[model samples]
Target: MTADDRRVARYAAAAIALSVAEAALPSPLPGIKPGLANIIVLVVLARHGWRDAAWVSLLRVLAGSLAIGQFLAPGFFLALAGAVCSLAVLALAQALPVRWFGPVTASVLAAFAHIGGQILLARAWLVPHDGVFYLLPLFATAALVFGTINGLIAARLLALPQGKATS
Candidate 1:
């Protein structure tokens, strides 16, 4: 395969791997997910571009939802909303000076926006009960924690030589 083709394959593989990792994480909350795969997304965004990362994020959610048997459920909608919001954030971030903040900061903000959008969408379309409000703190905490970790991972990964990453 060509160099570009190899890079695309590697990126796609990382995205899928991360998605599976995220999906396998145990969740006590019904609507909350750890978003571990976002680490790979940030890496892809930094290394490749927002457009490529967007495609990876979208494919990860759709294929992941199907594999996890949530394709037909409202969770699919939540994932879609989160992915779109994340992509929008990444696109905007790309327009900004990279000197202001690193991948971790961007990842944190994107995570916050992602969860916020998903929650709003869910409340508006799927769950009308106010009980869902109780999960805000939990969701926020997860986003902060996971986003930080994902950002750190991305930062560390970006520091490594590209050839060393797959080793």
Candidate 2:
């Protein structure tokens, strides 16, 4: 494989590992997750670019679902939708000035987009009722809290010495 391919694979592996680990945890809320794997995507976006970050994110969702035996399930679709929306938002956010809007802003926005996409998909396919919208506040709040934490972690990782393999 090419160097770039290897790097993407490594990043995706890391993300998948985190995803699997998160899956092992018992969440108090059904759809609420720490989304720690996203920190890898944010770091990849900052260091490599949006395309590489997208690869990492997509690969994580696919491989992670398979690893957790959730492929083609409702959880898989939710994850896929979230990744798509997160990547789209990250692409748009990349156009902003890096000086003012950096990894933290990108991470937070992407997190919200991810959750929003999942909610929409759930409402359309999983729940098929207006009642699903009632969970928006809880999901939104979780997104904000987890997104900020993930963003801070990504920003710190980005700020680390260049010797690390993340770049």
lDDT of 1 by residue, 1-167 (tens): 66655665677667777777777777898656667778878888888888778767887878778778889688888989988987888788787778988998879988988888888888888888777777889898888988888899899989988775443
Give per-residue CA lDDT, model 2, range 40-139, as digits (tens).
9999998899999999999999999999999999899999999999999999999999889877899889989999999999989999999988999999
Task: List candidate 1 segments past 4 Å from native.
Answer: 1-6, 164-167
Candidate 1 Cα RMSD (Å): 2.4
Q: How high a TM-score does candidate 2 get?
A: 0.97
Model 2 clashing residue pairs (backbone): none
Shift of residue 27 alpha carbon in model 2, Å: 0.8
Candidate lDDT values, in order: 0.81, 0.93
Which 10 consecutive residues of model 1 have the lowest summed lDDT?
1-10
Against the true structure, whose lDDT is highest?
2
Native-referenced Cα lDDT, model 2: 0.93
Lowest lDDT block of 10, candidate 2: 158-167
Clashing pairs in model 1? none
> Which numbered prediction scores highest in TM-score against the true structure?
2
